[model samples]
Target: MDQYSVPAGPAAGEFRDRSSKFVAALYHVQDEAAALDAVAEQARIHNRCNHHCYAYRLGPGPDRWRANDDGEPSGTAGKPILGQIDKAGLSDILIVVSRYFGGTKLGTSGLINAYREAARLALEEVTVTQQLLLTGVRLAFGYALMTPVMSALSQLGLEMADQAFGERAEVLLELPESTASATVRELQAAIAGVYVEEVGDDFEVEGLTVLVTPTGD
Candidate 1:
């Protein structure tokens, strides 16, 4: 997926029922490592809390996530949190709910509702925005063509993906797949057909199919 929504910044919310408190914090994470780190930090912060149940969506896809119920039944805490996140149509984010038992055992259903509400509340306070995914293109061109080639990229607001200089300099760049056809046309018109091609496998982002071509035959 090219674009998806993530938390604008960090946000927090809570839900209380029968004195049991479920506090949730939201964060934007790029990968599993960051998601786990956020969970660890929450655990550290709420060291004395009963459980640190969490759910994270790691990629543009829904299958790239895990829900940990912590110690509240098998599917009580984590699944509800994850369900809430998915319901909000968000990914690449983590919602960690720290629970403090108030001497009242919120049964399976209670725990589920509490966690879901907590996560939903936290998400409601966040600012959602779209993020783009970019892929690399290894563009090899004659040194002489660098001027117009660079100018074309500059005008399109495209950025270099790599930095390597040589006689026939190779410049890697990234662009959204949605503009691939137009971009290819622009580059072709500027440099002729001598160089420029897709380099890697086609990928998806922002609900667009993207492919890269290399200059080499």
Candidate 2:
């Protein structure tokens, strides 16, 4: 399956009318069940609203889902919100549009337009990036080699996963599958063959690597 990723911040919008207020909630989610649960929770929190409608996509999963309208007309609230998410080519996301009733009632079309516009406006403020499958690596080396190694890493414009000091200081690094070999070669040369390095097979969504023990072949 393709990797999933999302912006770190919450996306929200508030729209108003003479008799109603609509607040759209957009969040980046990782799993289908979690996204649906979040939507349900929001609905409960805003239970006093006239309607709580939501939509979500879990990519190719059996639960790739979209729901809406709640107690309103079919395809009015939930479908439009989900449409907005699909239009943005986003998955693992849940959006709930909560409506507090005003004296006047909006027709089905009006509800659809309001929900769609709210979602679009909220998403406009988000900055999205592609998700990648990453593997982690940890390297142990002497203190004397730290400066040169760091300099080499800087020259290569590589991001360090982490650095920690102990009996033997360790440097954690993450590399994309495509660049792993090149990174290993560069590090090996920088330390002048004095470093102990290990690579793991695990994958991560973020660009940062979380260190794990390397597998013994």
Tens-place lDDT per residue, model 2, 67-156, is 767788888888888788878877667788888988787887788788888888778777676565455667666667677667767866
The stretch of ten residues in a row with the least summed lDDT in candidate 2 is: 201-210
Regions more than 4 Å wrong, model 2: 1-5, 59-63, 134-217
Tens-place lDDT digits, model 1, residues 1-217: 4577777788899999999898999999888899999999999999889799999997665578989987779999898999999899988889999998899878878988999999999999989988776555666666676776677677667787675676666777666655655575555544442334432233221211223663211
State the displacement of the C-alpha of residue 20, model 2, in Å, after optimal TM-score superposition.
1.5
TM-score of each candidate structure, all chains considered together: 0.78, 0.58
Which candidate's lDDT is highest? 1
What is residue 27's positional error in candidate 1, in angstroms? 0.9
Q: How many clashes does the backbone of model 2 have?
A: 2
Q: What is the lDDT of residue 171 in candidate 1?
A: 75
Candidate 1 weakest ten by summed lDDT: 200-209
